[model samples]
Target: MNKQQILRNRPVGVPDEKTWELIETEIPEVGDGEMLIRNKFISMDPAMRGWINDARSYIPPVKLDDVMRAGAVGEVMESKNDKFKKGDFVFGMGGVQQYKLTDGKGFYKVDPSMAPLETYTGTIGMPGMTAYFGLLDVGELKEGDVVLVSGAAGAVGSVVGQIAKIKNCTVIGIAGGPQKCNYIKKELGFDHAIDYKNENVRRKIHEYCPDGIDVYFDNVGGDILDHALTALKKKARVVICGAISQYNSTDGMKGPSNYMSLLVNGAKMEGFVIFHFADRYSEALQALGRWVAEGKIKTEETVIEGIENFRDTFLKLFSGDKRGKLVLKV
Candidate 1:
């Protein structure tokens, strides 16, 4: 039997047990062009919250009674496709389930020798690609540029700061607690780390980047985005990655009141989805792999055991109970 978490209801705020139903069903059989994957690690992301919404956006929202859409790394246990063979390790949108059925579309092979499978779900996977392309391509990052990244201790934000440092740019990370702040500054080599929980974010950004912020990689939208907007340098680029703060709000998202600062500072803010750069994934994966091997980039994962704990483990993304990438070991 395959155990899966099905979306029971569209959440108004942070999702709870009532929003999901865990049930077991017969393991799906591989068809003519399909493969069966036994999921090993399931990625829990803030984006999952947006996916459950009834509203339309970049992609169609996940429908009712569907397996919760997610990314997972797993081993192919059965295969009918020529590209995939039994025992091959792969990654794809496998959902929050113990097993997945695929036709080889949107799935890629993963090598354990290159990096751990869980790392693919974190630093070398979707979150890593978001940080890489969003910072370098969208933000147009350059040497000596003062980069400010919100949610700096989380999955994508941590990588954004590290990559900036590699390019010889000054990096500032805004995290919730002192521990996370210190992890970014001391461990990840961010030039400055702001504890938004305790410090005045706008004031701290001013102190860290007095000359002004050249790139703002925003993951937490709301007050932090507003603060970063107010501190933009001339021609600064803001990358809209994710908005965890407003994802679950009963009211609609709050627009930045100080957005006029963009005009005054002659800066630009752009939003991007990683899937848009699907054709160029190899370029990012190769570069990120080299960086990790050279110890220029650091990767972290908070692994929770059991498929049964999906709902509770998912809440960690919002509560900041876990650091780095949150992954479920099934």
Candidate 2:
């Protein structure tokens, strides 16, 4: 039997148990061109909240009663596909389930020997790819750039800051607490960390980037993004990543009041979906894989032990209860 979390309802505020229900069904049969994967780790991200909305966006929303969409790494248990063999490790949009059966449309082989399987679902998978394209390509990061990153202890934001440092940029990170702030500074080697929960965000940013910021990698949007705008250098780039702060608002999303600062400073704010760079994934994977192997990039994952705990684990994204990647181990 396979246990899958099916979307029960579209959420208005924060998602809760009512949003999805776990149900068991027979293990699916692999067809002539299909494979069956027993999911090992299911990625829980802030972006999952956006995926459940019944609204137009970059990707189609997860339909009600369908499996809750997610990225996962697993081992192939049965396969009739020529491209995949039983026991091969793979990564794909496996959703929040104990097993997946597919024709391998978006799936690809992964090497567990290269890194841990769960790490692929985090740093070496979608979140890592997102950080690579969001910062280097969209932010146009350069050496000596003063980079500001919000949600710096979370999956995508964490990678963004580290890659900035690797590129010879001075990186400042914004996280929710002293512990997370210290994690970024002490563990991740960020030049400075602002504890957004305890400090005055604007003042701390001004203190850290006294002159101006060259790149701002935004993950937790809303007020922090507005404050970041006020400190942009001339021709600065703002990479608009996930907006965790506004994803669950019943009142509506907040727009930055300081957006005009972009015009004043001749800076640019751009948004992108990682799927647009699908063709270049190998570039990111190779670089991230190399950095991980060289000790230049570090990964921290909080693994919850069951598919049934999906909702509880997912809420960690908004509550700041977990640092780094949050995943459900099946």
Candidate 3:
């Protein structure tokens, strides 16, 4: 029997076991042009928090009683598509399930020779793609630019900071703890890192980015976003990839208090939904894959083992317990 976690209720705050129910089910069969995959690793992301709400967004919210939405890396067990075969590893939005059936619509075959199976979901996968387009295309980063990123220790944010470093730009990362901040600055080679939990965010950003920010990659929006906005230089660009801080807001979303800086400096801030660039994903992937192969980029994944821990694992993002790309090993 295949086991899956179904959303049992909408969460008002941090989700717990009560928010989801684990159920046993029959194994799904492959249809024409479809493939059946046995999940190996499942991605747990901060964005998953937003996906639970039934409000409108880039993708539809997961319906009640349906398998909780997630991206997974798995081995193909059966295939009716010429593009996939048995034993091939693949990755996509396979949800939180022990088994997955894909119509080859949103799935991609994984090449382990290039990197590990888990790296696909971090470096060569969604988080990597989100960082790439969100930084280059949306942020319009240029050489020598100073970039500021929130949620700097996270999957997408870590990559965003690293990619900025690779492009010859100065990078400043904002995370919740000293350890994560140190990892970003020392290990990841970011120029600066601020621990929002310890230091004054606005003051640190001002001190580190003395010339003002040239580009801002926002992940955890709210006060940090307001801080970054206040430090934007003339013609600076801000990319809103995810506002994790506001995802579970009971009072609704908050805009930057320093948004006037945009008008004053002629800077621009744009919100991006990664799927909008779905057609050009391969273009971004090819370049990003090359960087990963050459060690110009690094991928970090914090995996939790078990399908039964889906609800608890997902809440890690909200609690800031996850240090990198959060994934569940099912």
TM-score of 1: 0.99
Model 1 stretches astray by more than 4 angstroms: none
Candidate 3, superposed: residue stretches over 4 Å from native: none
Error of 2 at 120 (Å): 0.4
Clashes of 2: 0
Candidate 3, 263-325: lDDT as tens digits? 999999999888899999899889889988898887788888989888778878888897878
Clashes of each: 0, 0, 0
| Worst-scoring 10-residue span by lDDT in model 2 | 9-18
Report the C-alpha lDDT of model 1 over 25-104, residue by residue, as the tens digit: 99987899999999999999899899999988888999999999999999999999999999999999999999999898
Give me the runs in candidate 2 sitting further than 4 Å from their true place: none
Error of 3 at 311 (Å): 1.3
- TM values, all candidates: 0.99, 0.99, 0.97
lDDT of 2 by residue, 68-187 (tens): 999999999999999999999999999999999999999999998899898998898889999999999999989989999999998898999999999999999999989999999999
lDDT of the structure predicted as candidate 2:
0.93
Top candidate when judged by lDDT against the true structure: 1
